[model samples]
Target chain A: MTFLRSALVPILAVVLAIASGAIIIELSGLNALEAYKALYDGALADRKGIGRTLEKATPLVMGGLAVAFAFKAGLFNIGGQGQLVIGALFAGAVGYGVTGLPWIIHMPLALFVGGIGGALWGMLAGVLKATRGAHEVITTIMLNFVALNITDWLTSKVWREPGIIVRTPAIESSAEIPRWSQLPTGFALAVAAAFACWYLLERTTFGFEIRSVGLNPEAARYAGISVSRIVILTMFISGMLAALGGAIETQGIVGRYEPGFNAGLGFNGITIALLARTHPLGVIPAALLIGAMEAGGSTMQFKADVDPEITEIIEALMLLFVATPILVRWVLRRRDTSEISVGAHWGDA
Target chain B: MNTLSRYRWWFVTAAFLVAFTLFTAEFQQAQTTAVLAATLRQSTPLVLGALCGILCERSGVINIGIEGQMLGSAFAGFVVASSTGDLLLGVTAGIACGMLMGAFLAFLSVSLRGDQIIAGTVLNIAAIGLTSFFFQTGRSLPSGKTSRIKLGPLADLPILGRVFFSNRPLTYLTLLLVPVIWYALFRTTWGLRTRAVGEHPSAAETVGISVVRVRYMNLILGGGIAGLGGAYLSLEAVGSFERMMTNGKGFVALAVMIFGRWNPIGAWGAALLFGYANAVQTQFQFRGWLADDPQFIGMMPFIVTIVVVAGFVGRARPPASIGQPYSRE
Candidate 1:
């Protein structure tokens, strides 16, 4: 019973908030039932819609992991956008530009290079935090803009793909990450990445060290762990994960590098990371859920004739509820596994 | 002793590197000077935004919502100035709007001790949505851009007049405000308190400092500065309200704060670095240097911003107690 209650907290919050929003549309003379039905159809009713949701969820999983990894070190890394930008730019560069390589070599090489680019960018912030005591959150955020500007410059100038639309040349057919026929490659990648993150976070010595430092750096230091190095490395890994997401986007969805299309994926990572309670394995479900909301948003907008702003409102309320889970816990008065153990390691770190 | 103390040498290095690159920029345009001036003027909003971040963080508040505050003020400033035709009046309205946002942030993050990041992001989302929905509110007629006023005879002058004072009075004011902000942040007794609170809020309270009060004051003040930046974007630089006039300058300003390493003078240097990038990019475009692929040139600033923040292998230093909400036990 307790486990059920705990597990239901996030689910209940989202369901109720969405219901309330749906009701508001109904009260505003829109057919709430039909609107939700359309949303359902748009998000999951069809194979293609499911594929779209998966495609969206791909980046969220990586972004969530990126943020979750940072959270384990008690660091806020808002630079996922910067990391993602570098990752995407470099990935596209490798994906489309590199030639004369075999299919296997080319595909993995592009993805690996993309992740490395993002990781390097992220590592810079980590090093700053580790050595110079810079706050990663703001530093990363700022770097995001710089990354954006630089990516814009590269795509428009050096990587321009012929006339009009200053994007890169499309990836070669040999380099293309093949889709599962009509199915999305994104979902498979996200699932694999989630397993990788789970193993790294839950079952590894490194994850243990990161969480230990996060909980109490002083104690972790006493235990002879290089706390600063861990902080830096965790953020690097986090960034690498996010970069993988961008690489996947390049390979799976958008085909070529285009500025503004992959917009908000990194920022949305923040939302996904927090929603997952910074849990490693939990990122998968959280990302899928958010992806569902995003995927269904247009349908809800079309059928209900409601503004898409409602989707944002729903997401916000969900965040509010999750962030302030005490309210839900107190109201429901139920015990569960998902209860966020706050005040556990506040000042110690 | 003065040799090590002379930090301007570092500044010189920074400026020289950027200048050398600009010179390397292919085929400088006739309007190169004008573009430089405009770019410097354009960076005013970002500088102001960075200053806001500096103040709030110095006083122990992580103000991620400067982006939202700036946008809110930009929208308000645009509507008011367009209708009123008085830049001063519109700017005042913009500041008030910014202050309101600051107050809310203080109440939530300071008094209520809410998570600063969450509070900020929530505000950002709300600001975007609210502004988008009420976008059509308060228009003189059914339509066109807003009215703008030139500063009159004071606008045309040589040297300091053209480069510094000529463009927009606000642009000049931004430069002047930097020193004042620096002195206030570093030298004054209040400045001491602000730093003390950020470094050790508990210790500050033990010394009879009201941490919450100082944070609240700085929060609102920072908002006002950010508001001024936003107003400059609309009422001065662009002279019209656009959906994303501030663009991601607020975010870039956050970087400048870090690149500057959380100090007033440092912020100025960082802003100049970013401003230099903007100037060079614009100049390159004007000279028809990258006319074939101008879109990529447009991305130079963002790229440079990230690279600069990444800062080789070195790290950036921030205030000791940034991003922590005060909760009295």
Candidate 2:
């Protein structure tokens, strides 16, 4: 019953969102049901659709983890973009350069390298916040612009495909994540990472320490937790997870580092993290749901003649509903059990 | 004097390094200076956003939706400007749009007691999608075409010209705005209260000051200023409205605000530095210095941000209660 009630909120929200979307479509002079049907069909109706859904979910899982874990430590990590870019770039560099290695060695090497690169990138902001009292939100955001220019330069200059567009050379076959027909190796990795997050966030002392630090850094400090160290480390790990997403996307899905393709994905991770209630384990279902929405975005347009942007509207509505749970609570007549320290009050921290 | 008071030396050294790279690179000095001027002009919108950030944060409101607000203005400004062919009307439309967004965000986060970060992020997403949708939908119509307003050679005068007059009206307004805002922040009575409210609203409120009202007013002003930034981009900088046109400048403005330590002078200084990096990257790339591998060259600003922020340890301080949404309870 508790589980059902917890699940009911989102389910009910989804119904309302869908209904609202249908009404908009009706007003716009289209078959509302047909648009929705196309959406579902595009997301999960068949092999190809499911394949696309997983490909979309692969990076989302990593991105959500980046945001979620940082949320655990009460950090708003806008630098996921920076971390993701460096990680993807480095992973691609290794994947293409390290030839003759077996798949086992090469794949893990690329992933590890990507994760570390992301971690290093994140650490820049973390170190500043810890030492200088600069907000992670501001520092990471600044770093993101820097990362964009850097990655753009790298792709255009060194990583460019011969006489072609600005992107890295494709990874060697050995570095490629194995695909199971329509199922990408990246999807399997995402699933494993999700379970791993579940174990780490809900079942470990480190996770507890991170959460405690997030909840009340002063009290956590009194309890002997190294708050500043934890903040920096938490951000580093959070960034690394996000970077892993980019690396996997490159090696397994996209096969190259392209500019602007991962538009707002990292930033969107914040919305996903909030909707997931900041639980690392909860991010799986949240990411999967959002990933499906993203994957089906194109079909939603083609069937209804509505711009694909309506999907983003629906997503934003979901974020809106989740962010302001009071509205949901009022409709449900539930207590204001909505607050979970979204800001986490860093200056005080 | 404080230990490590040689911060200015670090800036000088960094400046020398970048200048050395720019001079020795294939780019000509005139072109480099021209690019710097262009870059300054490019940074006008970002500077305006940073200014808005400074205002709101001073009054103890974290205006995260500056990005969204900028987008709204950029879109509205471009559409109106393109239609009317009048920059002022476009700017007014942009400001109105930004003000609406700001008012909505403030209402939800500040008045309604909603989560500020969540509200801001949601607003950002909605803005991007909403603006892009309209941009795409309007593409079929004539109103959605990109618009521009270049004062031509007015963007190039003498000493004052390169410093101020060399750009469009937006650039001039942004530069002229710095001292006025600086005065307002430190000299004006309202600015004093604004900072006082952010630092300690309880103390401010204890003495006949209305914390909520001050925050609300500052937010609207800040939002309108950010709207002007958006207008600068669409009408002056790029002279067009692209999908997600503001890119990450709003977020960068947040960083610039922080890097500047919430002061108007600091904001201009940091923005100019960032703008210089941007101008240098383009100039170097065009001149073909490290042309084969100029990608990293473009990334120098981000690297510089990291270095700058890291260098700010024990020094960089934002407005007190900057992110904490004020509740009268």
Candidate 3:
């Protein structure tokens, strides 16, 4: 009953977003029901659809965990895109540049390298914020552009295959993460990571310190917590999660790191984290739902003659509703008026 | 030394501009006016966006949704102009769309007391999605780009003429707005009240000023300014709409606002610096000076912004009550 009660708001938010999406479709002179039906069919009806949905959800799970972890440390890490790109590049570098290692050794090494690459990027923002009082929001955004320019340069100049396409050379066969009976191995890793995050946040002393800082940094500092250390560490871990998502995409799905192919996978993490109400374990269901919508978008466009961009609209609406539960409550006429825990205010440097 | 350090950014910018002009002259003789003109042209939307931030933040409302507001209005302007073949009408529709988004933001951030950043993120995501969903390719403007108007005798001036006197309607308006907004913010009675509310809403309330009303008004007005910037993109600059064409300008404008220390004139100055950097980059690309890698040059503005934000210049102080929700007892 408690679980159900806790779940009610997210469920309602999703419902409202979908309903509003339907209204938008209707207003656009398209059949809302048909579009939705087609979306459902494309995302979940067949084994192929389920495989695509799971494949899409894998990285989102890692991205969601990344953001949610940082929120616990009272940080908003918006540089997921940069971190992911860097991670993908690093993973690609290791996967292609390294010699003839065994499959088991090479794949793990690439993923680990990718995660560390992301961690370093994430830690850069944390260090700036801790030392110079730069806001993570601004620094992360700047880092994103820096990462993009640097990576684009690398891909086109140094790492480029001798071809017309602007992409890195493909990863070696040993580094490829195989899919078993249509279920990707990366998705399992993502699920295990979610559980690990849940355990760390729920039961560990380090997690307690992080959460304490998030709730009240002043109080945590007075209580002998190193606010700066926690901030840096949390960001490092967050970046690792996001970059791991990118690394996984390189290894499991894309086979090579292309500049435009992985766009928005990082930003979508924000939507997923908010939709899950910032719960570590709640990221899975949220990711799966969004992943399904994304995977089905093209099919909806094809079958219903409706724009696939509607999925993004619905996702945005869901974010708004989830972020402001007060609005949702007012709409639903609920008596309870508690707001969701927003970890940090923008005023925090 | 203190004064020199205080005016460090200014000195650096002036020196860089002079050096860049000389360098360009060395390569392409007599192209200084074109470069300066391009700088002003590129700074138009940036200045407008920064002014929008100034208006909203001065009134204690943190609006990170300037990009969304600009993009939405740009799309609206393009769609209306493309369909109706009326440029003025399209501009009106664009401003209206921006104001509508402003109202939505106000409703979420002010009335609902939600997180301002999240509210802004929603605006951005929704704008991108909605614009793309409705966008159709192959739409053309009825005429051409917004024509440049000559200011009589001023247009006959050597270098300054092309750089300032002769420009499109929106560009001129944007230049004019810098002084107008600076006066309105620092001189007028409304500005006083707005500042009072921004710094201390409770105190403003004690003095019989309605904080909520002031915030709502500023946000709406700011949204209109940003909307004008958006319309400038589609109607004046390109004469066609592209998905996410506002790109990262809105975010860059935030850096400009901070660089200017929240003053309209200062922000315009900062915007011009950014614009100059962009203009020089484009020229370099055209001339193939940095043909080996143009990416590093493109990264300069963003990198500089980070350094400035990290207090390489000086600490930028925001309004006291900025980003906080006010509640009346």
Per-prediction TM-score, chain B alone: 0.88, 0.87, 0.95
Q: What is the lDDT of residue A132 in candidate 2?
A: 71
lDDT of 1 by residue, B1-329 (tens): 68656676575766675466557543344344565575677568878999998998888777878888998898888787767767677889888888888887888778766667766776675566556644663354223233333456654554334555555567767888899999997889999999999888999999999999999999999999998888877777666676655667787788787677678777877787778777777666656786876656766776676556554314544567776777666
- Put down candidate 3 lDDT per residue, B60-86, tens digits, no spaces: 888889999999999999899888989
lDDT of 2 by residue, A1-349 (tens): 7656666666666667667767766776888888888888889999888888888888888888888888877888877878888889889989998889988899899999989999988987788878777778767877787787787877777777787667888889888887898788797787788788778877899888988887778889999999889988988898898899999988898776787768778766886777777766667788888888888879988876777777777777777776665665665677554445666474543
Query: Residue A210 of candidate 1: its Cα lDDT?
Result: 84
Task: Summing lDDT over every window of 10 consecutive residues in candidate 3 chain A, give the lowest-scoring window.
Answer: A335-344
User: In order, what DockQ does each candidate have?
Assistant: 0.21, 0.46, 0.57
Report how large a share of the reference interface contacts model 2 reproduces. Answer: 0.64
Candidate 2 chain A weakest ten by summed lDDT:
A335-344
* Model 3 lDDT per residue over A15-59, tens place: 989999999999989999999999999999998899899999998
The root-mean-square deviation over C-alpha atoms between each candidate and the true structure, in angstroms, is 4.7, 3.9, 2.3
TM-score of each prediction: 0.83, 0.89, 0.95
Question: lDDT for each of the candidates?
Answer: 0.75, 0.78, 0.87
The candidates, ranked best first by DockQ, are 3, 2, 1
Q: Mark the 10 consecutive residues where model 1 chain A has the least summed lDDT.
A: A340-349
Ranking by lDDT: 3, 2, 1
Ordered from best to worst TM-score, the candidate numbers read 3, 2, 1
Computed on C-alpha atoms, the DockQ of candidate 2 is 0.46
Candidate 3 lDDT for residue B142? 84
The interface root-mean-square deviations, each candidate in sequence, come to 5.0, 2.6, 2.2
